[model samples]
Target: MQSLLKNECSVLVFTLSGLNETMENRYVLFSLTALYYPLIVFCNVTIITTILLHKKLHEPMYVFICNLCVNGLFGTSGFYPKFLYDLLSHDHVISYIGCLIQIFVIYSSILCDFSTLTVMAFDRYVAICRPLEYHSIMTNQTILKCILYCWLAPFFSMCLVISLLSRLTLCGSTIEKLYCEIWAVAKLSCFSTIVNNVFGYIVTLTFFGHAVLIFCSYIYLIRKCRKSIESRQKFMQTCVPHLFSLINVTAAFMFDILYSRYGSKNMLQGVRNFMALEFLLVPPILNPLIYGLNLTIVRQQVMRLLFSRNKCDE
Candidate 1:
């Protein structure tokens, strides 16, 4: 009881211990991070720039892909800059408000990815399953609404999460992740986190329902396309990449959640960090590359832009 009272819920700075046992390779880690973060930024920016400039690539599908890349950048920005800084410095601590902000940014971007992918699935459903009504259903106004849903839904979800977290009376200040995470911070609370856990599950189940809808839509699409060779070919060309991305993001999210909640200390620190980071590391780079290589229009425009630039240089 005395020790509990002494905890006081007054910690101003939260210490991160994810790297505490692995500081021997700080320089190598910093060097790799320094190189990798810029690569993520470059790839995402290229996609966004390509989409915005090319009138032909300005379709609803491509626009959603651009938004996914943008969200990737937003999510990485929340972690990489501060992570690189922490690698250089001996101390790794974040202010109370900074932790809240980081949680909001990172998680919201994740949820936004799901929302954007949901839109993409619907776009493909209309395009392949109901070809004639594609344009009428996926109008400029409809695209605008989809964009709003992608950004605004996640923003509102995170706002509620942050508000709830801010009210908690924390009993500790040590976080065991590479960056601020919602569950890690909530675990420090002195009081009952039943409400937080319930709301967190609600959010989890809601986004998961997004995944279920995407999966069901694909089932109908597969059945519909089975009748027509051209439709099958189109599904393979376009929908395959979206399927890959969905699987990739879903796996990463599962790893992070499972490891965060139930990870054993017997496991290697490096392995644990990888689980925590897989989502941020893989999806951001992989999504752009997958789409860029697989999509004929985007790839052709990219090559044209490159060849044109080469000719100019010569």
Candidate 2:
């Protein structure tokens, strides 16, 4: 009986040994991880600084941009270092507690991303549909309350999901993806994952569902803007940022769903590496550039900042 138990343990270990090895030689992964932080910091910092320095940008839209910059910075910094370390070391060895922390942070950040985008959509809705009442409706106190709600909603949601994930008894494999994703880790459990799947779908509905509503809201908003012929340029300007944000969010949700549902071994691994680049690198880099290059005020501020720095050096 003891010999049989020992054999079972040995087989389990042997079968799972190469799990992390499949992620090796991913230089693009390494480059992305290394490049992610500096770019995130630079873009987010520039955004926040540009907004703070210019009194003209203290409106609701820019306020939300500042909030987004802070959220993106936290998300990038919180997830990437540990993820990069895990990938390079080929160590799928995360403590159960560590795994829980990782899941909470990741899901919370994702929630923040989605919620902020939704709030930004509402801001556009008000700006386009109810321009006269925009100021009274989007007061500083109201915006602050929205921001607080955005953070809190995700905090509670992720806590519930993390609790459900923790109850799953991991038996088959310890090494999940390059990082600890709740769904991926839950699949390795010995027990049934019916509850996990159910709750996951519910969470997806609540979060991503809100995103869909926001998308529809934008569609209506654009139609309303078109009817208000006087502000056509202003309407398009307001929409460009939201349009980019919408595309990024949709791509992320689709990639995650596909990878979770139908992804095979090689495909899953490839998707994992590329998804980080797709979601993190592209949006952070593009958002600031879009706002900076397209908006005259932002472009002038950035150019002035650069010009001042060069003169100071001389």
Q: Rate the local accuracy (lDDT) of all candidates.
A: 0.92, 0.72
lDDT of 2 by residue, 1-314 (tens): 56544433533321112235456565766787687667778877887888888898888888887777777777666567766675566444666667678668766877887888888888888888888999999999989988897799889989988988766555555444555677777777666899889988888888888778987887787777777785567767877777787678668766766775666666555556566335555666666777777778877887777788799999
lDDT of 1 by residue, 1-314 (tens): 66666675467789999999899999999999999999999888888888998999989999999999999999999999999999999999999989999999999988998999999999999999889999999999999999999999999999999999998878999999889999999899888999999999899889978988999999999999999999999999989999999988888988888888899888989998999999989999999999988999988887777788799999
Model 2: lDDT of residue 261 = 66
- Local error of candidate 1 at 296, Å? 1.1
Q: Over all chains combined, what TM-score does candidate 2 have?
A: 0.85
Clashing pairs in 2: none
Local lDDT at 54 for model 2: 85
The list of candidate 1 runs beyond 4 A from truth reads 1-9, 310-314
